[model samples]
Target: MLRSSLAIATVTATLIATGLPAAACGEEDKPASEKVRVSGAPGAVKNVKAVGNVPDAQGAIAMGFLQYGHRDVMAVSGEFGLKVYDLTKNPAAPKLIGEVSLPGLWETEDTEVDVKRKLVFLARDPRAYGGTTQTGESGIYIIDLKNPEKPAILSYTKVPAGHTTSCVDDCRYLWTGGPAKAANQPADWGGRPIWVTDIRDPRNPKTAPDPIELARNDGKTDYVHDVQVDDEGVAWVSGRGGVRGYWTSGYHRDPVQGKVRRATAFSPVPYAGGGIEETAAPSKFMHNSFHPSGHRSADGADSNRWRGRDLIYATEESFLDGCVGDGVLTISSLQNSYNGEGWRSTPEKPFRLKSVGTWSVAGQEGSDPTTGDCSAHYFDVRGKVLVQSFYTQGTRFLDVSDPTDPKQIAYFRPADASAWAPYWHKGYVYVADNTRGIDILKLTA
Candidate 1:
């Protein structure tokens, strides 16, 4: 039987950890945990184009994967685990060279990569860990990528909020846009802000700007659904269907003498309180929570909440069905601004000629996971490819050559599909299909 990449799944999607082991990160060289075996796709053909298989023996299915650097090592995160592999020798027919196992860290919703640090970050899957109701930062595991075969376990930080969708370089910040839902009874439907963490030390990662800087999405409107940062480390978050003027008003705080004072009153728990609480924005700081607003874009000759594409790209995921499913891909550029002396605010507008694009799943063949919900929906690394998988729509690829004119270039859908996100590795695709199997795809230029 073919061995596989180190665990493979959640870690790669949340941060960046390619296994092949480049020369070394600076001079701090490290070794992998064990000797990973060389495993191949179950039934491979010539050129292989792409291959997909279960990420680990447990079989949660690989959900996300990423590759980095001139060396081309691969890192993929999944439903139950995280792993990295080396595809440098054979990009087409990559063999498992390195791997990591995150037993309780399954249900990996998404991942992001920091190639420079040879690390892959994972956003914990609430369902797998305990349930959406259980509040706590989904486990954040970082994999050392110096030696693919002998990769080391860097550290796993516990986040008390929900899991994050992506992380930026500088390794200082990572953002999770999902609302802090109830740990087990996920029906509260709270709107959460983008939980940004400071991982400067990695071992003891802390929330930046503080977790108390935001609120959750109410059922009536959109909340911050997803986010991404640019090379400059500016965070662009999508306030799916943002609404204004709604918050916990019962609580109060005051500046007594020279210090900020506070008061409180009992109220129903925040959306997913007890488990998923609003980041921690107090009523007194409600204005602070909504400081950075949207500006108009050039095409609309309008404004958005931010500007400058150098630091980030924040787009609104079209949520339909009264704000449950995804509909459009809101496109815009971004740059961070220091406002009111570090109060942190951004005025934005549509960055491109068009700020909205219909990314509805159609014409694709597959048994989608949900009746209609796109998860892990995102723009690819080349910044030219928008890759996302609908729970039922399958893996859809759009040629973002024009960002504004993001057209479907290629797609893959399996009849009777399951619930796994699709990932791109060295022009190839890897998917942890709910229970079907891990799949690989080779995309054309």
Candidate 2:
């Protein structure tokens, strides 16, 4: 049964308190003994070891960062709210310095950070704190990160969409998106779309009346999961249909509308991207994406085939009957996907991008076949290396130098692992796990 992350958390907490097996939480379908016993890749990936772990601090979800003086501090958001840790003293073992107690803060998957403004945006899902979609409060909590040791909530700005909040236009604005439709939502909508919020003045953040990135799922306005801004200032929205990129800043030639227009946060111009092919990902839901070339190379570069932001590395999140049927890491080429093909796509006349490659951990090395919660979740890339989290399947390290065929170079999955998101910080990879807290890993291969 594919349950929401919050519902799983609520059930898991109850199961754990009553001394019941956590396998019944609808996350891990197998017993702990049947899960992966080892913690690191021995032969497949050499020298990749778990250096440090914060086991007691369970219910950890996603990780973000904030600037503390000259050091880059780590901020974790999960069932315990948000906590700031100093990794300077020991990169492997982070020291907890400050924290804000948001006990039931649910589903802030990709925590957004404004390094320059010293702020953190925590998106509150409607299902947070045992609330239903009909009456649950959905909004954003602007946390002042100026004082890392004592973080304070600046304000709670309400918005229609709140599954994840992403900083747009250098944190001047925000694009918040969803879990499901709230009360009195559009009848034609399958799920929630994105809502723009003006946070230029962080204290008094104002939300736009309307939403952006409409009709994302094959012409149907569906669930917009998360937003990731590329290095070129183009914000990519991922959800039920696929991944789409929009220019949020300067004047650009709108490929879809075929005109030059100045793009704003609220009114973005279609740049590139569309839906992923069904062959690569049967489930069209793209949890998130990362454009490797967006940060380094120019568009249409001839040096490398995958460079020039021509390809998008995305994670298809799905929980099926078995781990083999779950989501996989998909590498899609944005060759002919531009010109608003995704926006123009319909159920009968669908337009999907060409998938170059795909990777899964179902029958991979050091995998536990019994574990059912094996869908790929959040991932982080560094150079040619990409580290991804797959719930009970663990943290996987892949070499994406060849974008068409991503090969697993290393892996770290303990017996009681429920890795949510893996982040590459400094030289170590920090994994925020639901069962285990923060597991710091080092890759020597």
Candidate 3:
């Protein structure tokens, strides 16, 4: 993998000379003539700042936030490598400060940034630079962000599964998910299982030599797309089968099996889980999720109680022709699933999760007329507000204070938008747009 070290440096130098902070490709040599398409109801969010590109706009995929001293730095991951921009000087307009070229780095949906430890974990999918799903080398690249301006890669440990990697148990361990099945992998495996990596020693990160495939609800090697660990230290693995919550490290009675057990990264004991039961939901393909506890209903009647009642905000990433079967956000109750047949149940007797609410961009206002993917991708939840990305639909803000009836508070949808993910930081929203680059927005009161 290090064979492209020289090429990486060469590409970096060329890009620097071309003058970054320029407009996206197809308009790099031109001026800012095209007006940015902005839309939202009156008193909605405002697009205070709009920029073209950061470094490699064409390959810009995901965005991560980090705060260094009083300055705010954002790391954007793309095809070639990762780019860090200093947003402290001006949140609206970012200044490119660092670049690390990774020539063949594949699809990086999410980059886990440990601001406390000053490290960023970049996952390398099996699908190589060309975007082919064929088996290839998949792993995570550990980068030291101690010097924000000049980042360095500590090491790249090859893991069996690598579509996305998330830090668990306070950055001491990393649970990498998604399969780029190796030659010796089991033939019956569907997609991927959770692969544990002990990164307590960042310099010498160690991953299990063999794959740890946990038999999921379907009694099959379920495809674990992404893992979202809640504030309560529950690692929720979402995939084709559904979403299952596991206790990584804790001493609690199993909600489903009704037994006392210890959990760990390598061996996750099931807490609670079930399939999403929504008629409008096309596929059961659950992308990613967010678990918020201690949330009371709008009327202040029901709240997350002592027994650990919480709400699961999940995004379904399904795409189809003519904007049909687009993904949406499904709100489910963890308590309902806990009382039912959870992770311990088998395929013969499956229980469905109770979906409380669902919000989509199917018939929503400000939708692009052109044929494109309207499916929801990655999103960020801040309090009662959920900022989600709906491909060409741009970024939409939904007020989930009333979980059942989510009100559309604000939105920023450009005609040519290819919005990927949205993150709320410092009272502002930063969206990773594939077309118009990173769009900075401010939510008005």
lDDT of 1 by residue, 1-445 (tens): 0011112222222224433111110111111122121222122122224444443423433333334455666565554466666667765545666667655554444466665666667665343443432344454666676666766667776554444555643454665544334434234334444555666676667765334324222222212444443332233333422212111223322211223223211111111010011121111011101112232233542122322332122222222321133333434222222111112111232111122223445333332323333322333433455565543345667764444456766665554343345555556666655545556677654
Top TM-score: which candidate number? 2
Q: List the residue pairs that clash in candidate 2.
A: none
Tell me the spans in candidate 3 whose CA falls farther than 4 Å from its real position. Answer: 1-56, 179-184, 210-213, 255-258, 278-280, 294-309
Q: Say which prediction, candidate 1 or candidate 3, comes out ahead on lDDT.
A: 3
Residue pairs in candidate 3 whose N, alpha carbon or C atoms collide under 3 angstroms: none
TM-score for each candidate, following the candidate numbering = 0.56, 0.89, 0.83
Better-scoring candidate (lDDT), 1 or 2: 2
> Tens-digit lDDT track for model 2 on 1-445?
1133423344346445643223212222222212333233222334588899987557787888766676868888876788888877777778888988977777677987898888989998776776655567889999987878888999998888777899989999999987667768997886789999999888899999999899888889987888998777888888888999999989998877789999999889998788899898776778899876444433443322455548788988775545677789999888887777877899999999988889998999868777657778889987778899887788899988787778888888787777889998778899998778999999978
Better of 1 and 2 by TM-score: 2
Report the C-alpha lDDT of model 3 over 1-445, residue by residue, as the tens digit.
1001112233234336643211100111111122123333232223333433443454566778888778889888766578888988777778889979986576566777887899999888765554333446788999988898899999999888887888887778888877424545777765677889999889899998655536663567656777877777888887655788877887767665668877778776677776777463446667788777444456664344423346677777654443545677888876667653655456577667777788888776655545355677788877667888886677888887777888777777765666778888887887876556677777764
Q: In candidate 2, what residue range of length 10 has the lowest lDDT sum?
A: 24-33
Best by lDDT: 2
Mind sharing the TM-score for model 2?
A: 0.89
